[model samples]
Every structure is written in structure tokens, then in C-alpha cells.
Target: MPATVFSCRWFALCALLLLGGCQPDQPAPPLDQQLYIWQRQWRPAHEQALSASRADFSTLRVLALQAQPKAGWSRARVDLAQLKADGRPVIAVIRLDGQLPALDLDRARAQISQLLADWRAGGVMPTGVEIDHDSGSARLSGYTDFLIKLRGLLPPSLKLSITALPAWLDSPQLPALLQAVDSSVLQVHAVSNPRLGLFNPGQPRDWAERWGRVSDKAFYLALPAYGIAVLPDDGGAPVVESEVALNRGGERRELLADPQQLATLARQLRAKPPAHLAGLIWFRLPLPGDRRAWSLSTLSAVARGEALASQWQVQLSARDGLYDIRLDNLGNLDRPLPARVELNAEQCDGVDGLSGYTLRQTPKQLIFTRQSSARIAAGGQRALGWARCTRIDQGAWNVYP
Candidate 1:
């Protein structure tokens, strides 16, 4: 395999890491475990916690099954039971299809019943179910009916979740489907057509705009675990690989996300997070010996939620009648010192515009040189921030002090 050259900004690397990586045999955490470390670089923390709590190490889920089920219902049953005993949450992803599977309803029910029994007996029920289906105009009545039936059959204690495509933004069936499942995870990675590179990634932004309109309680933000290599003329399946970056010396290397990007994601979740945004989950695991692989170290740091709070604390003191964005420690906030602050009046205070002023520590705020007109008016301030945010969405600016 040829080494990948690092091209985009740090954020782009993080996004790609979530999209295209493919790996096998990474351990799965048990369902009973409190933390589900998706990225492998985080193993140390898991080990640390295991030692401290004396908690039994559990199973970690693997996306082994294709979108379609090839084996018989009995085979699936056996797999489900084994995964249950292993203690990891079993996420059986079924791609969307208008036609039912080869198994009859009776067989499906029997297998499901057995799986549930085994899970309960082993004290390892799934955290929830995950369904990855594309959105289309063909009226998903048949699929919806199946889901409704599945919900009725499952133990009420368990949750039913589905992965949604960007097209859900326009489809009429979404409302009904959202009503059917316990939670819906929007695949924010490839919301647009992969062939033309027509991705606007407006899906997350659209969610933010309508957060107030929707009432779906828990939603997951499903980013890509690997990057798609688009071909000219005709669209083809994207080649999935582990994370890799090339240094100035031109050597292929694994690129791990800096603490800044991780913390930014956490803040996004905290601000306009998906309603009931439980936690972030990195897509598919990395391959063994892949240089750019995301490791357990990154996962552990993110899970602890210290990736952000530990760095860049602000102590507000009025300086020259303007709020100065100070730093307790110069972590990622590197530019210069004693930076002046100012906001762009024209673009400030809106969802779409890159609102608010950012200051560089090079002894001055370079971006806005003139004046600071950014003000919080009482009446308009109610909806200005994420006071009404109830869904996952794009952020207008980085929440930095």
C-alpha cells in the first residue's frame, strides 16, 4: 500500500480517520462496561479502569456482518448469543431494504426470542440496536412496519436505533421512522453523493436550524471512520484504509488527532449536541500496524472528558472596557500574548455567519482591527445562542474564550 500524504487541515484528518479505516480483531468492550472505547489508542485508560474497579473486561462490537445477511437465521442466532456471553454490546447493523430478509417472520421471531433470552440470562443485554439504512422516496412502509414489530417484540428496557442518510432531511417518511425508533443516528460523513464530491455537509447544519422543531429525544452523530477515494466519470465504492499522514520528509505515518480537535467536538456536543447525545463513537476500528491509526490513548482522553477542560481556561477581567479572552495556560491557544479583542458587527450573532471575534496573541487581534460592536441584547439573546438547540448541528464559531 502506498503511504498517504498529509494534505488537509488537522480537522480534515480527524474527519477522515472516522470515515475510511478498516480493521479486524480489535477487542470489543462488554455491554455492562461503562465506557465504549471505539478508537484503539485508548486502551491504557480501559486497562487502568479495569484494574482500579476490578471490573471484568467486556466485549467490543465489530461490524462484521455486511449490510445484507448471508447466513441463515440460526447462524445469526448463534453469533448473537456468543456476543452476549462475551459481554460487549452487540450492534447488528441491517442496511435498509424494501424487501424482507430470506427468513420468515416465524423464524425471525424465534431467533430474536432466543437471543433475548440468552442476553438476559448472561446479564448482557445490548446497549441498543443499530440499523444503517439509506433514505429514499419509495415510501418505507414495509420497513417501518418491520421496525414497529421489532420494537413491540423487544424487551422495553432495550433501545432501538437506526442510522440515517442525509436525504432524511427532505424525506417525508423520516417523521414516521423517527417515531418508530428509540434514536436515529445521522451519518454526517457522506451526506452528499460521493462520486461528484458534492458534499456540502449541510445535514448537520440543517439539524441545528431545526433543532427546536424536532422532538426526537436521543440522536447519534455518525461520522465516517474512513475516507472515500472518488474516481472520475463513474462513481465506485470508496477504498477504505487506516489513518496515515506524511511528514515534510515524505514518510508515511499514522496521524492521531490533537487534543484541540477532540475537545472541539466535545464542545459541539455540549452546545448544540444531539438531543440526548450520550457520547461520541468513532467509526470502525483501525487495521493492525497501520501508522495513522487512532489508538486507545485518544479514546481514553476523550472519554474522560478532560480533553478540553484541562486546557485554555479563561479569567475574565475588564481591560480597556472590553472583555479580554485570557488563558490560564497557553496550550493550543498559541499565537502571541496580550492580544486585543473585537467582534465583526456585520457577521456577529447569527447561526450561519462566523459570528464573534477571535484574537491572536501576537500582541493584537488581527482579524477585527476597527471596533468591537458585539453586544448581547436581552430580548434577541434568548434565541441567539443554543438556548433552543435540541439536535446535532453545525457550529457558527469555535467556543473559545
Candidate 2:
């Protein structure tokens, strides 16, 4: 054999080895997704929201009933006709007030039974029943007993599930509680102090690891795709204002989950999924006119581990000295409306803005300002204002972050 031929073969082998080592990592497997339609009453918009989100979520968890401190009990007027029409696997969520003094097993059982009857009569049979009681750690033993009794009355074909809290991990009875149900949904959203905001990005990963070790059965994680408005503290518990109206006398601070951060977390969970971790469940599906929830495009992207972002652009149209200025979001995420928008115009007869914006005009400029933060939906545009001028150059505009 020639020395040159031997050297060439050796180099080729080395190149092949290098290529193998440099191959891209395997893509993470897709995770199953579910959504919680938590509105108390089913309106026209709920049907629209559900119809549009058919591709993103497989199962629907509807708010069926809720028990409050003094409100006795109120049932969710869920749209049965629509649910029957959609014909998707549904889970009815029954909420028990976390602050209740004791677990009234009899009352809760009655409520569950009646709810099942009502739903069945409407031709909307639920695949499972989930008790969303945020009971305390000390009450875990009692809660377990209640669940066992509740499970006894449920149909054999239907599954029993529970909405579990991270704090339950410290309780020794958590295993027993898990045993009473087929599967559990670990709610990692809005469990911490309201003053600390709704969710802590780093904390959920640690909690998930610990929960995975303790639970033997299949479980899913409940994540936040919505925001909460925290009313000013009045020396008592913070008021959480969701879709409900709160007439409390104080200012409200809006806190929302970051879509990009959540998207990254989803990717991490998929890349190295926890043991027995079934999938992800997004809390409270967003509707068409929902102000606190993320847009469907953004939520779907996060669920699929896609990059989250919104592209903001200034749209200016002029016809015979009448110019219409607007802000449009071209990307797939909702964008916070600009605090201030400034445009340099050569000459302006008059200028103004709309939707909580005031016009600030200078000799050669036009400005629109708003006091509170708002958002522009993906593929949606908002009218910033219009100007009657010779030329309102589209290129001479600045939008402040």
C-alpha cells in the first residue's frame, strides 16, 4: 500500500468521526396540551374561543361549580349545547373554598352528584371529574377521606382527578391523597404570595423535580397563561381580580406571565421530561376579548416550544393631506401599546389620537400618549391618531418601548 493512500483513508475516517460528534441534538418530543375554560358563565365569546383553539388543546376542563365562604354555592352556567356540539373529551372542575373551616363531605358529594346528573341530562358527559379544592396541608388526611367517599359515588367508567397544590408535598399524607385519584394536576401558578407576583420562573422547576420523586402515578403540570390584577393592600389579604369585578377602593397592579420565559421552560421540560410527567395544562383559556389572558397565537407557540415575540410596526396612510396613523403587530404575540409615539411632520393642520391617548403637537411633530399600559393583539392594529397635513412621512416616526 502507498503511504499517500493510507494517509488519505485515515483523514477520511477522522472527518467522519468529527461529523458524527457534531450532529445536532435530537428534537424534543411533543407534549400533550389541555386548557381550562374557567369562565363562570358561557357566553357567545366562549364558543368562539373554544372553536378557534381546537387544534391547540385536546381536552377541555370546564368550571362546573364553586363553593365560597358565604356565597353558599354557585354553579357555572356552562354552554351545554355548544359542548355537545363540539364533542370533545371534557372534565368538570368543582372548586371548594380553600378557606372553608372543614370539608363537608356530604355537601360536596351531593353537589358532585347533582352536577353529574345535570350534565348528563344535557348530553354533555364528562370523561372525568376533578375536585379543585386548595385545602391546607394539615387538612390532607381529612381531604383524602372526603375524596375516597366522593370516589365511591362516581361512575366506574369515569376517572377521578384532583387539583393539587405544591404545599401538599410537605404533607406526609400526600401519597394517600394521590392514591385516591387516578391522576393529579399540580397547580404551580399563583400559589405564592401575590406581592411576589403570580409565578416564579426558577421555583417551578425545583418543585416539579421534588413532586416527580414523590408521586408514583401519572401527573400533569398546570401553568399560567393569564395575568392577575392585585388590588392595593388594605391591611388584609390581597384582592385577586380576574374576570370578576371588584369594587374595592384601591389601585390595581397588573401582573402577567412572560410568554418567552414560559416557552423556554416548556422546552426544558420536553428536553428532559420528569418521570411520570404526563403533559402540560394551561390555566384559563383566553377568549376573543379577554384582557388578562395571552392571545391564542402566543399560547400555542409556548405550548409547542416555539420562540415568542411580537413585531411592532408603524402604519401610516395618507390621501389628499389626510393621514391615518396606526400601530400594528405583525408578529405572533400580543404587544403592549406604546407609552408614547412621536412623529415628525412637515406641517399639520390638526392632530389627535384615540383609545386613552392624548395628542401632543409641536410645530413639526405629532405625539400620542397614554397613562396605563394596554396591548395590541397579534395581527391586530390600533388607531394612534390622524393628521391633516401636506405630508406625514411614514419613515419619520419613533415608538418608545
Candidate 3:
């Protein structure tokens, strides 16, 4: 062969080796420096959570008067009224510390009637009423009787809601007790303190499933805002803290609402949606003066809604413009808002000839629309979808598509 042609062939061979095709496409550049925005920032990861509510009032049942001292009933009533005035439907639980003044059934009837009348006249009839009797009282008979009579006396318009003993799910009397009320609530506190009945061991999901079997109607799962300290089994009363305390393991531990656990509940509900999964209720309203209060608020937000936006991914061929995304359902339960979708280049290599891209749903199969542009690069992933959903606690529309 001629020297000139041979030299040309050798040069072309060298060019092919220099390109990554010689080395198995260079393993797609080893995915150098990737970014991830988890489902927390995305939409519809969990449906059971309530939506982010701008208005303070939410439709889910709320338990009020839990944090007030026993002596503060009258004051607590007024405070609770204010919450009602704010348009939030509340569950007014009169805390019964096992003290009844001389079996005044007649006076009690009058008081109950007048209270209901006044609340109704003010257009603030509670969603329901409850008695917090967790003291393992043998006097439950009297309390139960009072509620039975009260339910009979009150008009059917008002709902009767109650919290049961930790053992109530298995209590033989629970069926009769449930018969008197519109709905029942099971408080799921970690029994670090066995003093307050057997800490219903097992997961909230399991408890919810079991509770579903006990009641044919909707019910609420009660989650405490604090953690309880289990004392030595000398029959000492257990201590409950709203904040994290140091464990004997010397670990800085706090018992607050765990979002991941909440998410797990959400996932379970999504997977199996209990027949009796009425809703979730957080114990003690307005949050006590503790840092866990923030956790409560965050959990409330998660219950309501959450949204996520992916980092601006680059598609060299993507055109620079707004891309319309048609999601399968538009996430009606999420309540997302209108937002800007901008075009951004790869922070590292702006010269990759505009790699291919698209604007699609998170779970691609859930999308209902196609890309507005032929090739969507940076602008596609930034496109926004509006999603709306009803929150379990706060019945407000949560937007997060």
C-alpha cells in the first residue's frame, strides 16, 4: 500500500481509540456528582398525610383541653372556644381525673344540655365530645353510664367521640361502650410506662388493623406528642416527656413525632387503607412549650402535603421554553400551585451538545400528557404539575405537584 494511505488509516485508528467507544463507552462518565431530591419534596408519595393548609382550621378531628391542668377547666373551655371560633372543628374532651361531685346526675344533665345549646346557638357545635379517662378507673361504669345518657339526650346532629383505655380494644365491655358513641379513638402511646395499662406493644399499623376489626366505623389513631420513661417495675408512676432526654445508653434521645414513621403509616395505609382508618389525631392541641411541638407541626404538614422538584437536569437537545406536563391524575388530592420552570445547563460541562431530556412525571407511568417541546432538556424536568388532596387532620387543599 502507498505510504500516504497507510498513514491516513493509522490516524483514523488513533482517533477511534481516543473516543470513549474504545473503552466500553467510558461507563457513561461514572455518573459523576449526581443530585437527588427525595419524595419528601415530591408529590403523592403518601396520600394519608393531610395537605399543607394556609387556614388554621382543618377538617380532621382535633382533641382539645388535654394540656390544661385539671383546675383550668373553665379557662380551657374559653380557650377551646377561641379555637372553635377560628373555624376549626374540635373534640372537646373534659378530662376526668376520677373526681365526681356527689352523683349530681340532674345538674350534670342540665350542664350538658346548656353547653350544647350554647355551642349550637353560636354555630360552634363541636365535631364531637370525649372523656379522657386513662387512670385505669373502676369508676368507668359511672362515666360510661353518664356518656350513654348524654348520647341519648343529645340530638342526633351532634357526634359522640371517645378515647378508650389502652386495653379497650380487647376489653369485653368495649363493644357495649362503642355502641353508645359515633366513633372511638385508640391512643397508641409507647408503653415505656407500663403503669398506664399494658403499653399496646406492636406497630401503629398493626394496632390500626386490629382496631379496625373491633369497630365497624371510622376511628382515630391517637399519637402522643411526647415519650414516656419506663420506671423500675416497683409500681412507680411512669414519667412522660415532650422532649428528648438522655438515655442510660448516654445517647441524646428525644421522643417526638418521627416523620419517617409517619410516612410508614402513610405507606401502609396507601397499600392497605384500613376499613376503619378514619383519621389520625395528635394528643394535646396547640402544642405545649416544647421543641417537639415543631415536630408536631412538621408532621401536621406532612399529613397535609409535601412537594418535590428535581434539580434542573440538562438535555442538550431540549428547547428553552415552558413545557406542559399532563399527569395521569393531576394529583387532585395534592393541590399543587403554578410555578416557573426554567432552563439551566449542566453545571460541569456546558458543552455536552445539549444531551437529550424530557419533562415527565416522577413515576413515568402516572403521566397523562406529553412534552410540549420535541426535545426537552433542562426545561422539561423543571415543569410543574398541580396536585390537590384532602389532608386527614386539616381538611384544607394541599398543593404540591
Give the candidate number with the greatest lDDT.
Answer: 2
Clashes of 2: 0
lDDT of 2 by residue, 84-163 (tens): 88887999999998987887878888888899899999999999999999998988999999999889978889999999
Scored by TM-score, the top model is: 2
Sorted by TM-score, highest first, which candidate order results?
A: 2, 3, 1
**What lDDT does candidate 1 reach at residue 329?**
38
lDDT by residue for model 3 over 147-189, one digit each (tens)? 7887887677778877765555556666667677888777776
Residue 193 of model 2: what lDDT?
88
**Sliding window of 10 residues with minimal summed lDDT for model 1:** 378-387
Candidate 1 per-residue lDDT, tens place, 1-401, comes to: 32344444556878777665743444432112232223423333333333332233232433322223443333222233434434445554433332434324455556556655665576655666565555354646555776788888777877777766655556666678778988766655555545434223334545634432464566655533233333232245542233333222322222223334544554555555444454445553433332233333333434445443223233333333333322233321211122232322221221221233332222211232212222221111111111111121121222233
Regions more than 4 Å wrong, model 1:
1-111, 117-123, 135-137, 195-205, 208-212, 224-263, 274-278, 285-292, 302-401
